[model samples]
Target: MKIALCVKQVPDTSDIKWTENNTMQREGVESIINPYDIYAIEAALKFKKNYNAEVTVFTMGPLQAVDMLKNIIALGIDRGVVISDRKFAGADTYATGITLSAAIKKELPDFDIILCGQFAIDGDTGQTGPCIANLLNIPQLTFIKDISEYNENSITASRFLDDGIELVKVKCPALLCMLKSDFEPSRALINGIIKAQNSDIKILTFEDLGLNPEDVGLKGSPTYVSKAFRPDIKHSGEKHYCLENNSGAQIIYDKMKEIGVFNG
Candidate 1:
């Protein structure tokens, strides 16, 4: 099995700060690989170890994101491919999916399986994986909790749902959006780290991928953020002292319900 694992680097949500110009102030902010992506990597590694498969990782981000890919390589996977370009900045899910599909086509021509996280923590949209599948014109299973069965020709997986789960069988040359429980990410091995440090990680630019400037990044994005602002704080402590099991409390609750607070 030749698998392609898509990973991404995201900003630390906890330390996200905005600049005076209303954009994210990335300086001094910590960044890490997307947590969900680790599950995808772990799944690919499992296939590599158990089935003697080949796993190649691909990441799309700035040049600095190479650090994350190097760390991924330290998990005993195969080589990593990075796609970074200034023209790819400010891409929404649609643009990102298109760009990644182009890169995947250019890089992994004979790949059989494509794996990605359910969603990125920074974006939280859960759209990129499916969009990539759409761009590739391949069948995809999203929110997959486990790969129940897989071989060179087909794959059976369990898709996570709100109340239950759905079983899906997809043909080869397919894409999957893996959930966190797909597998546990491995720790970096010393030998693997050394090999990763010595490996020549391939870097692809925008033109290298044969992308049109208008087909990516902010210019390619149809959805635009007109304005960004923080939600206003409306809750204020207004606790009233009352006896336990008091009818007054029930009355207040009923009044709040009448005003639609409870319903909302």
Candidate 2:
């Protein structure tokens, strides 16, 4: 079985700085692999160990994102691919999915599964994984909590749902978005770290992915952020105290009354 793990580089939550354009300042901002992606990688690593399959970590971002790939390689993945170029900047979920789909189609064949984190920390949109699956026209399951029961031709797992949980089954060559905390990520072995430091990853440019200028980046994005601002913090609210033996409901009612909820 062959597995592909899609990971992303995000600004370290601890140290965040903004650019003049209000976008995250990547230059010098400490970065780490997306936490959710770690879970996906760990899942892939488990499969690789049990089945002796090839594990490839794939990422797309600025040149600095190569660091993230190095971090993954240290975990003993077979190889890594860095899809980086200036033209890929400002790509929204739609364009990102399109580009990744194209890359997967062009670079890989005979892969049995694709895995990704639930969402990128920086974006928090939780859209890219499903978007990639949609672009590939493959079956997908998100928020997967387990995969040990998975098989070569199909998989059975539980997904997160608003009401509670949902059990899902999907055929192979499918995509999954996993919650990072679902499994504990492994640390890099000493030997693996040394190998990773010297591993040669295939660095792909925009052209390598067969993407045109019009098909990626901000121009390719359908949505745009018109404005962004930090909302003023407001911390004033009405508090009610119990009168005599009044119940909690009565206190809430009195507070609402004071706020004129009873008034027409």
Candidate 3:
């Protein structure tokens, strides 16, 4: 079986830079793999261990992301591909989904399954995975927390919902957006490090992916960030303490009435 692991390089939130147009400037920022994507990698690795599946990690980022791909390859993925291009700059989640889907469709047409993190920390929109599935015209399950069974044709897994969890079975050629799991990611050993350094990570550009510049980047993005700024700290909220439960309840009631939470 062949598994496609879709991953991403996200900027460190603590140290962020923005472009003049309110978009993130990622070229020179320090980056790390999305934490949720670690679960996706673990899933692909599990498939490899149990079924001898071939796992390829795919990511979209700037040229520097090549090192990030190497990092993933060090985690036992069979292959790695970095989709990078200057033309792909300033792409929103929608455009990014298009570029990644096009790359996967053309390269891994026979892939049995695609795995991705539920969302990237940088954007946190949680839309890219579903977007890719829609563009590829395949079934997608988001917030998948566990895979109970896997075979050549289908998989049974647990999906997390706001209300509760649901079990689902999906056929091959499906996409799964995975949530973080309890599985601890394995550390890279010396062999993995050596292999990673020697491995040939393939690079795909916009032209290589047969994409038009206008179809990607800001041009294809239907959404725009008009402004981004931290809300001013008007004042710190006050905290109240009551010695008794009844007193606390009474205080809360009075405050609610004062704030118009209670009518009349």
Going through the candidates in the order shown, the clash numbers are 0, 0, 0
Q: TM-score for every candidate vs. truth? A: 0.88, 0.85, 0.85
**Regions of model 1 farther than 4 Å from truth:** 18-23, 182-184, 240-264
List the candidate numbers ranked by TM-score, top first.
1, 3, 2
* Tens digits of lDDT, candidate 2, 1-264: 888789988888778776666676667887789988988888888888877879888888887777778878899788888888888889999988877777777667678888999988888998999999998888889988787566658888888777888788899889999985634579999998998889988788888887778988887888888898655688896566657666779777767898898963
In candidate 3, which residue pairs clash? Answer: none
| C-alpha RMSD of each candidate structure in angstroms | 3.4, 4.3, 4.0
- Name the candidate, 1 or 2, with the larger lDDT value: 1
TM-score of 1: 0.88
What overall lDDT, based on C-alpha atoms, would model 2 receive against the true structure? 0.83
Where does the lowest 10-residue lDDT sum fall in candidate 2?
A: 237-246
Candidate 1 at residue 52, lDDT? 85
- In model 1, the worst 10-residue window by lDDT is 237-246
Candidate 1 lDDT over residue span 1-264, tens digit each: 788899989888888998776688889888988888888888898788878879889988888878788888888888888989989989999999988999888888788889999989888999999999899888998988788787658998999899899998999899999888733468999999998898878898888988789989999887888898766788986676667656777778888999898784
How does model 3 score by TM-score? Answer: 0.85
